[model samples]
Target: MRGGGSKNSPLETLGENANLEISGDLISSSTTEKIFEVSTNLGNKIRLAHSSTSNGKVLKEHGYIYNVDAITGLKSITVAFEGELKLTTWYDDILNGQSVNLINNETSKLSGSDCAWFRIEALKETKIDSIKIEYTCDAKDGSFAYTSFDDLGNLDREGAKNKNVTVSLGERNFEQFEYAYDGVEANKYNQKAFVLGNTKLNKYNASVPNVGEYKFTFLNGIIKGGADVKNPDNTNNSHVFMLLPNHSDVVFENVIFDSTVSFHNEFYTNTWAYLNSLTFKNCTFNGGIFDFPAKELTITDCTFNKYINDNGQNDSNPIWVRSGAGQKGEVSLNKVTFTNNTVNAYRPVKFERLGINNNHFELTFLDNTFNMSTFNDTDLKNYGIYLDSGVTYHSFTLIDDGNVINGGNGDKVYAFNGVVDGNFPTKMGTKILDRNGNEKVIVGGKWKSIEEAKLCSSIDEVATDTNINVSSSGTAIDAIKSSFTGDNATKQSTTISLPSGNFSLKDETDRPSLKDKTVVFIGSGVNSTTYLANKSATGTEKGSDYSFDGAKLVVFKDMKISLGTANYNGFVRPQNLVFDNCLIEGMGHYWGDKTTFNNCKFSLSGADYNIYLYSGVDFTFKNCEFNSPTNRFMNAYREETSTEPIKVNITNCKFIGAEDTASAPNAKPVVNIKKYINPIWQITIKNSSLEGALNKEKGFYQAEEGSKGFVSIDGNVVWEAE
Candidate 1:
């Protein structure tokens, strides 16, 4: 009744004559080769009994059923015929998940990744070789791809005892699906078998992008788990989370996955445990990760925190990955970005792959930050890769597109690699970031640090001038040009700009107080970015001696501001300043403080750093052209005593490198960021490029701990060399 020895012929059992379960283990186990010739296109099926619970009692009316025990089951069902196969699965008692592999179907529009039920885990294998699968899905029971777990609001409410969410496809389905996790029987459904997401990517109206923060549909669901010995939370006091698959982008927003308690296998395996095309927005991870064998896993603006006094023994990471055996598949990181996420460790993501080598893992870390010194957390950090001794990743491409890393503990990483993976070289280490933040790898693994980065001194705060602003648009014009001759000084006027609206100038003393530098200036009755400038600058030389210094809010239009050498030795900072259409002629700019230069021209002939950065918050240069001559365009450093992170943005700006690579073979980077006393600089150089030669190796100096910074060279920002 079950197999095909004496009871029934294998050929007749696969036909319309026999409606009994065949023993695939019994049939494939023997070398006799009981080949059944049946037309798959004519709706033929080779049913198998459940591996557990019932020996698969539920059988289809007209198909050959085989025993589905993977331990003693048919390892593979090879169809020599090139045609469509409607792959359907049915729950057999408690056969957790069957992680099936459909090989030789590279062009197959197949389905089924890990599933809740054999019912939910169904696929139609459409082959390129004249095989077209039926584009239909038949759900049995709660076998549709969509699933949900719990509701939020209340604090400590655990859901139903049957907590597993499973769906499958078949003519027959289970009513009120009752499933249990018998941890006592460990390998029955191993602790590592927790499936967060296991279906092919689904289509929807609203989806998440690879980078940037998204307005996530918050599923305020929480789960209180049972006890486990390895968890920090065993007493059911915390609310944990496990992402349930919805066949598409389902954001687990604001939910917390408690690492206090081990949620099954926090470290992923190539089973139902892997996520496939899932998005997690604004979520928090205590244990961290649903990594390994992941397909298009997008995590945006999520906070990851993990700490264990395992006494430096556990190879745990916030997003950890390990596979003892070679996983022969593709695991692409469509977008594993962390723009606004806080990660604790120096290197939040740790991966150790010691396998036989058959994987293509291509990853690009763009526009995020890994601050703090984590290189000393483990022994592997000494090699700059933090890889275990026998680890071999031949096809691993870790691109430091733009990430800022602070420092390492053990030694200075000369050829800095991966802020995400200590193996990624010089995203921000040893070298300063490229104007656009791309780590153009030096040919050999050798690197030399830019010596100028160590020359930074702490910032000296200046006093705020209260009565420096002009009262009205017409009056502002008079105050600036009336005394603005060769000296670049105004008549007792510190900073002048048009008032926002219809300003009736009472007096210069009655202007708005810009002492706190908190107000945003906009053009009167025009776009916030555009102001009607009826007048142009009288001359193009001389950097302004009139400082926009202090945290004073000032906006300048059609003016020439100074980038002078004086007051740049950490004396004055160009804080809270905005320049539009300004001509900057001096050298050695200093102390960036929330400054934005738009449509500005930097005409300094030659100096050290065009922008001698000391300390401050941020700087942005857009639509600017620089014909400056210097060792490099910019270099920065922060003292060990400070904690404020520096951020610089140079976008849509063109720079002429001081030396050509061919002419001066030892040419260096244009933008130089320094090695710091911890807190990093979030630097983004996008839509910008250089016209001359630069060292192929040097890009940006590396950057931190809890707080993350944004580092990326996005939107075609490559340096040109001839």
Candidate 2:
């Protein structure tokens, strides 16, 4: 999608050259003969194969040689390069190629005048016959970087076995030799479609928003590394698609993630910890996934499928819970689809508690389907809904018909009330009807109530049955906040009793105290106007680009935001905050901090760029829609300094940019790349749709002319017109 020309005449934008035009299908390079003979005096004696003794003179330039075997009449070779490499061969090598009978660990010696080589035996047989290798020279810093023909999706040859490749850069290491075979003729042996490294995005003039009604409805675009934009919104703004916070609350609705959503390991310590609220509505998470870790989480009307991995086995359950070191919160799934991928193993969900505070579990698998064959007998030992806390108010609702709870490892399902067992045919398969033929509260699925199984159990007996409380909080807490500085707050974590009714941040004076905050919204449903400023507040610049490294805030929402006033600027400034179904748009001032937006829409205006980004922040967008500006989208840019840049990310989203925008002059069409020295913009865009006109249009020309830097676009659709 980054190159020029049609599929037949793609621009040969090789790593060796910044931009190169190619008319023919193949690009060739002449062989370089060694200046020195077999003498060891040339540089250092380099080992040819895996032999301990150095067999050939090591040339200063890093490369390799291919030789044919003399005995077996086979050609085999291996290469080690100083930088990135590109390898390709004729179509015949892969398609209808002859399969070789090379055994595992077998080696073939080369036979040429002073040419020493050995056939690197593959673990499995392959039909590959020919190969072309293109590599770059390493820099002086001992870091080897390379981009290959494989990245271009031009391998064209299906290998019987995967290639063994290794890359070393200073203390960093990369070892990828084999990839899964897609089974498709064009994609066989190429397990991974592409690899992104430290990419970035920069834009200008983000849209703004309105007031009261909160709205955030623009899907994020992921570029490798980071994305830095200069957004000055007119209203409050938050994130809308991330398992991790990206400077604002996230809203995940109608999106898909084929891979795992992780926090930027280079910048943040706790990845999935900061979340106000997370909601999954009409989305799909195929691989093992994680939402804002250690936060109030929820899922409704979504599909969570743990598809089988390449090994013909499933990864862990679809959801892996490492809830922020045991903070009290809830994880609810309603009208969701939990399908077991035929290609993988079972156990749809797993939870591990490691935090200090005990969690108040509220899990619901409503109207969901858990394919039976996925889970094995032993899976239930550590699978399904779990309450790691020894004592907590938890609920598990299986609302689907034919929902089978495999009775394995003697594990029984219990409702939050602790008496209503969550299984089929309650009361030991007895028909104990209530006032209207509904089942009785206490089924045989949970620990029994004492009192000799009497017909009329006393209140004291019911209380002592499971030693758990059953009373619900009559009223919802309007505001809750925890703000603890240093050690005192950490030591004195806030705790709210179970069944606390709907928590809401009603007005400017009413903010859930984040001071020493450990507030958990465990009630059935809660609503909060997250990141939205009060109507009376006039002088207040929207909390744009605010950083939250130590603050912990968790919230839940039954409905989503409507894309009103919210901040959208700077690198993730919030330490931990999550939003669910909250509309966040570019309306308020700029306050881009570390935050997560799950199941929210972003469709508003009032910022130079829809979202702005700065340094030291990591964010993610999951299943959110992104409708970019029709003209141009740019982030903050300084013409002089470049030390502290900006970054952001978007995944499993739908992006719609403006139509017929002109390309930025003398620069690529990326935001935050203009007016700076040594500027670095890291962003990654994957698995999304980028609808709208490309740079060839007039609108994009004006925008692209103003920026400079790297922009990596993969697995996205790019339209030529609006």
Q: How high is the CA lDDT of each candidate model?
A: 0.36, 0.30
Candidate 2, which segments miss by more than 4 Å at Cα? 1-478, 481-531, 534-573, 588-593, 605-608, 614-616, 628-645, 657-673, 676-679, 692-709, 715-722
- RMSD per candidate (Å) reads 24.0, 27.1
Q: What is residue 567's positional error in candidate 2, in angstroms?
A: 7.5
Candidate 1 per-residue lDDT over residues 545-642, each given as its tens digit: 22234535555444344443542332134456665545555554444367777656666643445565565678887667676444355665555335
State how far residue 309 of model 1 sits from its true place (Å): 4.0
List the candidate 1 regions with Cα displacement exceeding 4 Å.
1-187, 190-218, 221-250, 260-275, 288-290, 311-316, 323-338, 346-348, 354-359, 371-397, 406-439, 442-722
Return the TM-score for candidate 1, rounded to 2 decimals.
0.29
* Per-residue lDDT value at 409 in model 1: 36
Q: State, as a TM-score between 0 and 1, how close model 2 is to the true structure.
A: 0.29
Clashes of 2: 183
lDDT of 1: 0.36
What TM-score goes with each of the models?
Answer: 0.29, 0.29
